[model samples]
Target: MCNAEIDPKTVPHMRELMAGLPTNWGKWGPDDEIGCLNYLTQAEVLRGVASIRSGKTFTLQVQMGNPKGDPVWPGRRGAQRINLMDKGDFICGNGPQTPGCHEFADDLMIMYLQGSTQYDALGHVWYDDHIYNGFDAKSTAGGMQKASVLPIAERGVVGRGILIDMARHRGKDVLDRGETFNHHDLIDAAKAQGIEIEKRDILLVRTGWIGSFYRRDPAEFYTDFVEPGLTFSRELVDWFKEMEIPNLVTDTIANEVTLEPETGVMIPLHCALMRNLGVAFTEIAALDALAADCAQDAQWSFLYTAAPLKVVNGSGAPVNPLVIK
Candidate 1:
């Protein structure tokens, strides 16, 4: 939360900045937890299927347990994998026996569910004692009793994903820290790529931040810790609602700039887009490969599908989204 460049005293609260914005609270139903993902209907799935031209598939999850360490939000460490049993245990005569002359290796991982590329539950963030769909924030007291990632996983997200490579569109390998863009910027990038972002399309915006993380030292990457991405604006929220955009996938840890440049509020879009509008967010996706391929062939639209782990009551779940072109 320590952004050196911005003065905390001058920042407005999320509630204050998001006042008067539209919400999708009852747009689906009172019992709804999956939110705007409902827009990925059967016809949307077929539309995604129809966008396939080259039959090339790209997996968008970053590698977990990389020796060089994984890219995650500051203050959160990378996944740790520890071996429980191996040949050394058997040689030491301390291994458990299953059958005659049988040996096995076992390992365990400790990580934050949101430490990797993940789909955040609508209940993942909130203000004013309520979560998405106006569910009592108390439901999250003991691990998200409502609007957890389980419902989203059960529903699944499959639709036409339009890639807006903002970094490439701006003629840079990566956007500068704290660089901000809006719905108009997204449209401009799409237009530059000669494609249109249609209604109900799963929007994937790449800033190249995640790719740069692996190339630079962790300390340098997290210094001041502001990410370049979509900024908060009433018009941006209106655009998302008007376009019926279902899911927002980005390569940044938080989908938007670390702090809203206008109000100096942090992650206001998380509340405006997820809590209010029920828009699903998939963060930390590895999109460089996909972006490169799209640039090579000039095909930016594809069939995007992701199935996050069904973690009951979990705030978020890691997912390896599959994009087919």
Candidate 2:
């Protein structure tokens, strides 16, 4: 549906962009309103086809934090928090004294996205007055549902994947926090890795920042100037927008720029990626092992699966994402 009050010239390529999205089984009305058909007869057929394809799937887990360990943070104290606790307790009982089983239990704080490796939907963030899928930021404060909200459940992300080792590109075993990664650096890494990004692909970035924080002092890791993160640049945003990628995952604290000195702001990439383009993001993914495996096999795509907790209007969820190659 087109907005009559809004100037069509404002978004000269709006039609082209809309064409790129999947088919809409709904109707458009005046005032830019959309109404969906209650139940489509063809929906079941399409779902059956999808289920058939999903039967032969592979998966890999990309979580890093141990349940018995402390949570992973950026600062020195934060670093120590990871795996600080020991294996705690177990509840064992017998079923009518016939058999006994023990369930090991511990207070767990996981740092990875979606309980493990995961993706952040475009509805996760907003900028100015715009959100993912071109939703109005004002109307979203109350928490929009489905398309307006981050549809982590609806959009099953199964596609090609690419990993760019930014740390290796910079000739460092690991990167510290506050380390800036520019758009050019990303481009160079892609070139060096000999990977060509394709539309609807999942892009994975390995900054090595996770490794540094995992091994270094929390204070130093958080305050250090060598931690790798995606730097905010118009060019980078433009690149992703032009590429029309679907999802992005990274082995960093956040998927985008953090703590800009000049602007004193964090999450510049958040606004660009989540707000402008409807691209999903995931952070703190355990990618080192996966990256190593990929490097050996020269393969990137895998059966990637992540399911978030069903929390109402939650800003984020702890996920345990696994990739099966």
TM-score of 2: 0.64
The candidate that wins on TM-score is 1
Worst 10 residues of 2 by lDDT: 31-40
User: lDDT of each prediction vs. the true structure?
Assistant: 0.94, 0.52
Candidate 1, residue 320: Cα displacement in angstroms equals 0.3
1-325 per-residue lDDT for model 1 (tens digits):
3334665578766778789999999988899999999999999999999999999999999999888888888889899999999999999999987778799999999999999999999999998888999999999987989999999999899999999999999999999999999999999999999999999999999999999988998888889999999998899999999999999999999999998877778899999999999999999999999999999999999999999999999999999999999
Candidate 2: count of backbone clashes, pairs at least 3 residues apart or interchain: 30
Residue lDDT tens for model 2, 28-91: 2221211111111243224323323223333333334443332243431121123332333222
When summed lDDT is taken over every stretch of 10 residues in candidate 1, the lowest stretch is: 1-10
Candidate 1 stretches with Cα past 4 Å from truth are 1-9
